[model samples]
Target chain A: MIMEKLKLNIKIFFEGAYLSYVGLFRWLSPSTYLATLIFSPLTQMLFFVLIGTYAQGTDKAYFYVIGNALMNAAMSGIYGVTMSIGGDRWDGTLPYLFGAPANRMTVFLGRAFMHILNGMIGVLTGLLWGWLLFHIDYSAANPWALLLTILVTTFSTSGLGLLMGCIGLITRNVMFVNNTVYFVLLVFSGANLDLATLPSWMRIVSNYLPLTRGIASARLIIAGHSLTEVLPLLIEEFGIGLFFALLGYSLFRWFEITAKKRGTLEVF
Target chain B: MSAIEVINLQREFQTTIGVFNRKKKIVPAVKGISFEIAGGELFGLLGPNGAGKTTSVKMLTTLLIPTGGTAKILGLDIVNDAEAVRPRIGFIFGGERGLYWRLNATDNLRYFASLYYLDPAVSKKRIPYLLEMVGLTDRADEKVEGYSRGMRQRLHIARALLHDPEVLFLDEPTMGLDPVGARELRQTVRNLQDEKKTILLTTHYMFEADALCQRVAVINKGEIVAMDTPSKLKDSVNDLSVVEIEVFGIPPETVEKIKTLSMVENVSVEDRDQLQLLLVHTSKGAEAIPLLISELNGLKLGKVTTREPTLEDAYVRLVGGE
Candidate 1:
């Protein structure tokens, strides 16, 4: 039975990828990233490259590029999952999914897993781009550390996206969720700056977040430390990821039951 | 086992949403409605807007859990064995949002077929057959987004039949179709029923219900107001009359006077432009028409017409319009 449900879930996920060309993926891609991923990583690799060079050709040039890309990888799932789900609600297709006979967990994970592929695409493109632009070693990714980083990132961010999806189900607006996540992450995520250099209270706040600990751990691995060296951060970030995912899942399930009960499941 | 049994089924939405963005607004959608559908029956649920047909259909199909009820489809509990129950059912709704807009019609059917866990080999054969059944085989490769309302509705039906379940739940299956399209859809529904497929169809089009359903239920305000064969419901209103009048425009006083006409027992103005039907009654529709016309033309009306009692008239009576 378990195998059957898993296979069903996998089939649903792949079917989603073939959904349409004129849809969220193509409509949402910034076009610049599109050019680089297909063949030329050197395309627009110069923006951050310029940022690094302007900072006086620091050997850490490659590090910022990798960091930005990983940060985007963490966020790309949000872009993919939340938008697709928000689009579903916005378009009224959500009721069909909700009404389907499959388990909510299976359906939720099926859609969630699709975005992981999207996250991997964002990560790989940036990795290749960084390698092409500078002498930075792509081997900086400690295999085990890299996998843990990705797993943690996808879970936590997808949780954030899932929460957004539920909220969008209520509001039926994709633009609202998308813009809100973008700006909020821009400010608190330290994506644009070094976390260690933040104000003391801000640094303290960063330490308490899954994203911050994730970035710090990734940097540690890139600097040649083993996975075990970041054990405390790993535990902390992993726990936060689980918390967000479980929280999002529970909230979604509750709303689902409430909507069904109220007979408002098809309000859109 | 009976194809469907719903006993003392009640779904009450908490009038108020609570906590973590749970705003409290309780709206009871289905209230203690109970009925049974035998195997191979083409059952119809007819209701006006806000009648809770969708909610009831959702419950029976295992899409939404009942707040305080138990329903079994093919002897599988809707809640406890939903996954097992799902394979035994297929559902279709005509909302444009139902199909994946990006996928072609055939791909949409194939995707749903996979969810039913049909063997790949079977889908390869079944999809073309099912699409042909709905008459969309030629356009099956085009994205559903490009299909007209009728085409999409056809694709939705094809998607519903992909798994070939014993029971089907269809909400407004022919809602947006034209006359020819609606006729084809009703025919398709009848064909499925002939194959012993149990069907639950909710539609505002009483003609569809009357033509295709062997047994029908009418729900209003979240409760079953009436249920039985369509003929019986219509027979209950046997002495009823339906009057239709076409006028350039009606005057307020003329409408008021028509209500007081000797044989014009009850009269109400129907705003044809808005497509809102109003019910008026007299012992005989023909007896009242001349008076209805003189009163209308007396007010300089262009034309007026009256006709027989219909499923629409029965609907008005069931909804307690009289």
Candidate 2:
């Protein structure tokens, strides 16, 4: 019986994840997906890399490349996952979702599952863009370690996305909130700037955020550092991601109860 | 056991009144209304636009929590045991909004079926059967965005029945459909009733309630004014006559003046294209017609006829033509 239940849950998780992702993007033409998942991020990366190389010289291009490459995870995690969750309300599926007998945790967490994978792809695309454009050296990097760092980073970023998605339930201006958070992470997650150059307060804020340690750890691993050398940062990055995901889940549950109590489940 | 039960259920919303000096006001949407449905009965809730019909349905479906009182679905408390109640009940709030328009009908059903925790084996069989039941089998693979209003509404019915829920809540299922579409949907609803699925339907069409429901509750201002079978509710207006005055551009004050006559029980206006049909319900049959015409002396009157009262007359009288 227990095995059956677990199997059912696992099925629900993957099916839900796939369906939601497909539901969200199926309307877009292939070119729109290319623009959103590929070209847009590419241009943003190029803009920052050009600026960074201009300021610190072309030799430090690798630093900016790795930093901006990981930002793709944030893009997918924050924007893509958020849209998947918020789309329920905008598309008028919230009531049906709330009315369903599905486990809330399974459904809610499944929302980020596809985006996590997408985020990993986005990060890889960004790294590939860097390799093709700037000749960044991946010869010394451990391929496994780099993959693990990308997974953790994307997971952490998606955790934050889940939280923002819950906030989308009550507020009308969710896009505004999403844009503000994305730009804030760009500045604070050490994605485009050196952590040492940032002020004491900024460094402290970065320490608590999701992508900060992930970005730092990615830089170390790409520079040929062993897993043990960057293990502490990876652990902290994973912890931060887990923390945000749980916080988001708690908020998601709270929002559900509160919306039901306040009769605002479909208010917006 | 009753398939659905309610006791003094209520819901209130808080709205801010002013911009700078915002004062909060508690507005009651459902004022402790109560009713019940038998296991296999088709029940209708008839009301005006803001008559708390949707709010009441929302609460019973576990989409919204009630501020007071209690409800049960098949003996499960709607509040305390919502999760247990959810799988047993399915609801379709009418219109094009509830569906995932980008996905094909089959995908939409599959997704919602998973949400209801139906085994893959069951949904695979159930999805196609439901599509056929709603007459959408041929177009099951088409994106819902391309579907007509009737088709979307039918798909909604299919989605709701994916789990074979024992009870269904349909809020204005045919709100904006053409006559033929409405008839087909109503037929589908009747078929569901024949299968012993208890249904709670809320609609503005009196004829629909008369045609489909075994019982209906006329609700107004968040309260049920009357609850009985269609014929019984119609019987309440049996003595009254409905004087429908077709007039061109009748002034609003004239309608109010007609209401002042002691014989007029209630008055409501219906727009029939360019002409307005003023419906006056009164116990004084033909004798009250001249008095009603006198109030509209200057207006261009088309046709004034008196007919026996219908379930709509009872509704207009019960809701006081709000």
Q: Calculate DockQ per candidate and list them.
A: 0.41, 0.82
lDDT of 1 at B16: 45
**Could you tell me the C-alpha RMSD of candidate 2 in Å?**
1.7
RMSD of 1: 4.4
Where model 2 places Cα greater than 4 Å from the true spot, the runs are A25-28, B290-299
Candidate 2 lDDT by residue in tens digits, B1-322: 8889999999999888989999999999999988889999999999999999999999999989898999999999998999899999989998889888888999999899889889899999999899999999999999888999999999999999999999999999999999999999999999999999999999999999999999999999899999999999989889899888899998898888888889888888889999999988888888987888878888898988989988988887788777
What would the per-residue lDDT of candidate 1 be over residues B1-322, giving only the tens digit for each residue?
A: 7789888787767654656776776678888888899999988998988788987888887667788778899998998887788778888876667777767787777766765667678899999998889898889889787998888887878877777888999999888788988888888888998899999999988888999999899989888889999888888777867776656556577667777767755556667673423346777767766666666565445444566677766777778652
Model 1: which residue pairs collide?
A: B14-B26, B15-B25, B15-B26, B16-B24, B16-B25, B16-B26, B17-B22, B17-B23, B17-B24, B17-B25
Best by DockQ: 2
Best by TM-score: 2
Tens digits of per-residue lDDT for model 1, A223-244: 7788889878778876876676
Spell out the clash pairs found in candidate 2. Answer: none
Candidate 1 regions off by >4 Å? A1-57, A131-156, A171-192, A211-214, A217-243, B11-31, B65-71, B76-84, B265-280, B300-307
